[model samples]
Target: MERLQKVIAHAGVASRRKAEQLIVEGKVKVNGKVVKELGIKVGENDRVEVEGIPLEREEPVYLLLYKPSGVISAVKDDKDRKVVTDFIPYIKQRIYPVGRLDYDTSGILLLTNDGEFANALMHPRYEVEKTYVAKVKGVPSRESIKILERGVVLEDGKTAPAKVKVISFDKRKQTTILEITIHEGRNRQVRRMLEAIEHPVLKLKREQYAFLTLSGLSTGDSRELSPHEVKQLRALVLHGKNRA
Candidate 1:
């Protein structure tokens, strides 16, 4: 037997939270009976349906979104702010973001309803590498770069070592594009690191995460991840540390 919400999520109905909402709203039925309780259990012999459609356990769905600036990386925002879900129209499942992007930060963000996969990706032990491109106020000195590459003391103490590469310097634009790769997903770590070195980031965009990239997707748009992409992401979570 499995929890109803878990079954609903595994069937690609929604995230566990949303599935519970569906249950509470009397939209989900099991074995031809409406179920409104959150912790109701079900077995393989039972039948489940949502909104009149019989639910089937789908192959786990994954998506890569080119999250635009000024959008919150949350499934729902109480303040009525623009959320990443606003751009994903075709995804009927209640998938949530694997990690997060700041309201003003844009780049590759993963969305999925697979609970175990989400746990593995977000867990600190995984240490999945995330790469970002930051447009900063000024070109950082070699010493500054070294300090960032080595590690800097944030309010939370010393940060993990990150890989910093000065991609290009534009004197005319008075901006520098630097690439930073880090394994830990601290809150606003990239921006804080740059701030610590006196290089405030003007704009930031994540370019890659482990095996996934925001290659073909445009800003404010998303695509359902192919099966191969989903498998690759799962592999990254399962074996990322070994390769890292």
Candidate 2:
């Protein structure tokens, strides 16, 4: 059994938060009874409806795509650009990206049809780590690195603390390659963060999300995640919530 809102979300009717709102607004029904309570739980045998539409739950699918630069992260794009879903033409489930990677940023991106799992992993409270390797224009000073480690102010607000390391320096080209790990999913965050420290990124690629990596996959390659991997990810967010 699961919370009614969770079941609604799992069916892809809405996000968990939105599902709660729908329940409160009396738009959701369980077994033909309008359910306005947020805490109600339902079993697999229970029938659910949202906005008078019966829920149809699809089997969840999880995928890791080594996204190439210049492709959209969404299932479809308004401007008709190529999207991440285009890489997996054979997948039948209606999966969406868990979070976003910038159009120009490439590497480890997760796609899933499990709405509850996606919500948990993307929730701010869970703090799922994302690691990126960036090639920036200039070598940063130790003080600048420290500033990043502490947190930097952006247009939206101050970023949370980040883990940054200088991987290499190119004296001839006057560029630096560094790795930065952050949990926030702000738009253009990695680029903006480096820009805050006066080292604009020349190229950026995400290398990891949680413990998952783009180890064997090349650009535009993808694979279904193993069951164990999915279990581990779910456990990670659950454990994170417990710790929080």
Clashes of each: 1, 0
Worst 10 residues of 2 by lDDT: 6-15
Q: Each candidate: what lDDT?
A: 0.86, 0.92
Number of the predicted model whose TM-score against the real structure is largest: 2
TM-score of each: 0.77, 0.94
Q: Write the per-residue lDDT of candidate 1 for residues 1-92, one digit (tens) a residue.
A: 99998888777556677888889999999989999999789988789999899987655668889999999999889999999988887877
For residue 44, model 2's alpha carbon misses the true position, in angstroms, by: 3.9
lDDT, candidate 1, at 8:
81
* Candidate 2 lDDT, 1-244, residue by residue in tens: 8898888888766788989999999998889999999888898899999999999878889999999999999999999999999999999888899989999999999998888788889887888999999999988999999999999999999999999999999989999999999998999999999999999999999999999998888899999999999999999998989989
